[model samples]
Target: MEKLEEQIAHLTRTVEDLSDVVARQDQEIALLTRRVALLLEREASREAEGTGGVVLGDERPPHY
Candidate 1:
């Protein structure tokens, strides 16, 4: 029937739209994951070097 065909078409369009959204979300999540990994690696390297780059509020500036 025509009504059944119309319903099928509508459902198909909805599924396709949802699929596109999911694909885009997957890409964004992948990019963010990579960025987090790189940041962690950089922090680890800095810590391993044992540089006192961290300063406290009470500490005077090295320029002084």
Candidate 2:
């Protein structure tokens, strides 16, 4: 029937749209995962080098 066909078409379009959204989200997640890994590596290296000290409140600057 025409009504059934119309419903099928609508559903198919909705599914395709959802698929696109999911693909985009997958790419974004992958990029963020890579960035997090890089940052972790950098932090680890900094720790190993014994640099990157944390300054507390009321502490004088190292340049002082």
Candidate 3:
């Protein structure tokens, strides 16, 4: 029937739109995941090198 065909077409378009949205979100999540991994690696390296320090409210900078 024509109505059934219209319904199918509408559903197909909706699915395609959702798929595009999911693909974009997947890419964004992947990028954020990589950034987090890099930051964690850098933090681990700094800690391992024994150069990690704390910042106090009222203290001289580390370079002082």
Candidate 4:
């Protein structure tokens, strides 16, 4: 009975540790997702501006 209790305690600790790891990963994923969204918005704004006015990718010279 004592051995069973020890096994249960170890399992409980392992589950708690895994839960913490998952929580941290979830937070990181949320942060990374927000960053990616911001980056995408910035890129889109740049592309829109480039299309509206100047092309920054060296497509041609101003004289041509």
C-alpha lDDT score of every prediction, in listed order: 0.94, 0.96, 0.95, 0.91
List residue ranges in candidate 4 displaced over 4 A: 51-64
- Whose lDDT is greatest here? 2
In candidate 4, the residue pairs with backbone N, CA or C atoms under 3 Å apart (3 or more residues apart, or in different chains) clash, namely: none
For model 4, residues 1-64, the per-residue Cα lDDT tens digits are 9999999999999999999999999999999999999998988998878853555795886788
Error of 1 at 4 (Å): 1.3
Q: Candidate 3's residue-wise lDDT over 1-64, tens digit each?
A: 9999999999999999999999999999999999999999998999999877778889999688
Clashes of each: 0, 0, 0, 0
Error of 3 at 45 (Å): 1.0
Winner by TM-score between candidate 3 and candidate 1: 3
Better of 2 and 4 by TM-score: 2
Q: Report the Cα lDDT for residue 44, model 3.
A: 93
The C-alpha TM-scores of every prediction are 0.75, 0.84, 0.78, 0.78
Displacement of the residue 9 alpha carbon in candidate 3, Å: 0.7
Give the TM-score ranking, best first. Answer: 2, 4, 3, 1
Our model 3 lands, by Cα RMSD against the true structure, at: 2.4
